[model samples]
Target: MLAFRIVILAAFAVAAIAFPRAAIAAEESCPGLVARRGLPIVPASLAADAVQLTYIGHSTFLFETPSGVRIATDYNDFVRPRTTPDVVTMNRAHSTHYSDNPEPGIKRILRGWDPAGGPARHDVQFGDVRIRNVVTNIRQWGGETTLRDGNSIFVFEAADLCIAHLGHLHHTLTPEHLKQLGRIDVLLVPVDGSYTLDLDGMMEVIASINPRIAIPMHFFGLSTLDRFLARAEGQGFTVERRPTPTLTLSRTSLPPTPRVLALPGR
Candidate 1:
């Protein structure tokens, strides 16, 4: 009986180790490729010399320029005025981080969309904008103590400026993540303090990215906003709270030093 129990335990341990690696490998496979198979590739729908962005609410953003290139990040449900974006990227960390169904007519959808066994990786170009997604640690709903599908950090580049959005990021980025990040001009970051990393860790991330412009999102209210601004200011970052929700930007508009812009979400 004792010998049988030992063999059973050994088998169970090996199975556990083998299963996670297999799951991770499986989850890391591409979903869009599976969905589309091998169809002819169509070019993105965007124009040259146009770049603009707006903070809708939470992690939702509307980016379009005079030339009409639109993109959104973490566009979950409950968007006011029901603003639809040309491209929507979602990370399934929680309900707030994703929408059950995005508004109709969305041209492309990228969900970190990994199946239940692994991480996600993809490079996408929408219009003139180029986007790259890298999978980070997978976390539970509300990120409260469990891990599921690994979250994704997206880098968006257009009109000579690069923007990165860290979606529901629950831990500090690894060196591999930094290598994937490359250079970031503008960073749309979450400052909720608890759900994401705390203020100090966030400060460290900002220092690492060293973006010319830093925009805070996912924070609760004025106080949380204030804490973030205070930290940025101490780091010698100029804080600008744009009265207008939408702002047009270009490579020329990007500054040399780090600046934090707080846009009002409605």
Candidate 2:
């Protein structure tokens, strides 16, 4: 009888060893536990409240963080901004959006797609800024082939603001994509009707994102830009064309209603 009891006890110990109760509890209640300990929930905002965004033409925009961190999107040699960037992001759809020979001085270079035809993963923090990405599929060979996880939506978080740049997006976002994006305060979107998603599909994306401000990019001519502006205006978005290509933004400075701002660019 004592041997039988010892065998049952040994079985129970093995089960407990395989599935740790403490680990399960931690996994289920980590957030609550941190809150109870008074730990910081999110990263603190930068000392300076405003972040500057500069249009560098054709899907390339330079983001200047308050702490002097500069990030350029779609960084290729042809349309790259004059000043060197601290960090640069690229997409793989075309050579126009990426460069094989990036300047050696750049601190970080992030690519949206893996050269091996896999998904690219990036989550980096530098100074006052944090950058992350969400993967999406793209069309290749003139829509003859669909490459899985071929593009990325880069998100920059700084000064308590979330800025997202849709890089060579070829389709409407899925619910999983929205969950990954969270809340975007500023959105940089492509306005080219045929190359990226159609005008109607792009409008649907804007509505789903619901950013406080939307900036147009990737439009080759005024006609494409005008069509996007008109559609946004029809949806009750305030369309404003800025004389300059740069804008400084902060949480407090956001418009009461969502606005589409057009910056002059090549």
Candidate 3:
């Protein structure tokens, strides 16, 4: 009992010491920015830019281009009036990832289909953006015995920036997965640390990808975000909590080194 108590106490001490340093490390990576909380309201001029994105609750996101090309990701439930999108992508995770078709005028729909035989790779082009999806392993129905090819990691290339989304990932990324991912400028990752990989595992993958911007998603509650930020503190990534759920981003406006942008998913 004494030995066990000592081990537990030691673990807590390590975590407490590690968190502050991690936070400081995140601050040092970026020279000009400061860490601030709460959402920022986006201006109309920025909203009208060429590449604009808005978080629409949970995994649902609305991305629009100046040419009116709108794309939605994992959008199938509790979405707002702005739910209309030119294209929608649904991964094979759960019912939340898919739903009945849109009202009308919705142009394209993409699903991450992984069959026993194999999965199909999609090279999608919309306006000036290009996207590709690669399949990986994710447990189905939360069972260890029953394994299926359902989840996928999608890569989007726009404005000379490559962004990857780890969809319902259940396992650590292999070296082959790294090779398949090539170079990513921004990464939209899940940090729930329960349904998705834990904080440490998420760090491993982020380290491997080494993207310029890391946007965390699929996490609930404020403390989940805090813990994720804590885990990434000393990893040399600046953490910015944007003031709003929306952001106007382009290749030119992106930072040179890695950073974390916490977007509001509601």
What lDDT does the true structure give each of the candidates? 0.66, 0.77, 0.64
The TM-scores, one per candidate, come to 0.77, 0.82, 0.76
Which lDDT tens digits does candidate 3 get at residues 116-155?
4567477777665566786777666766653455777877
In model 1, which regions exceed 4 Å deviation? Answer: 1-50, 80-82, 142-149
Which residue pairs in model 1 clash with each other? 23-117, 27-118, 138-150
The full ranking of all candidates by TM-score, starting with the best, is 2, 1, 3
List runs of model 2 lying over 4 Å from the truth: 1-47
lDDT of 1 by residue, 1-266 (tens): 00010000101111111101111222222222221123323333322433567788888777763335567888787653245677888888777777777778888888865865677766876545667787777556543565644688887766656678888877776665666676666788999888788888887777766666788998888898899998877767778776766666665656555678888887
Off by over 4 Å in 3: 1-50, 115-117
- Arrange candidates, best lDDT first: 2, 1, 3
Query: Model 1 RMSD to the real structure?
Result: 17.2
Worst 10 residues of 2 by lDDT: 1-10
Give per-residue lDDT, candidate 2, residue 160: 68
Note each model's CA RMSD in angstroms: 17.2, 18.1, 12.6
Clashing pairs in 2: none
The global Cα lDDT (0 to 1) of model 2 is 0.77
Clashing pairs in 3: 22-233, 22-234, 39-243, 39-244, 40-243, 40-244
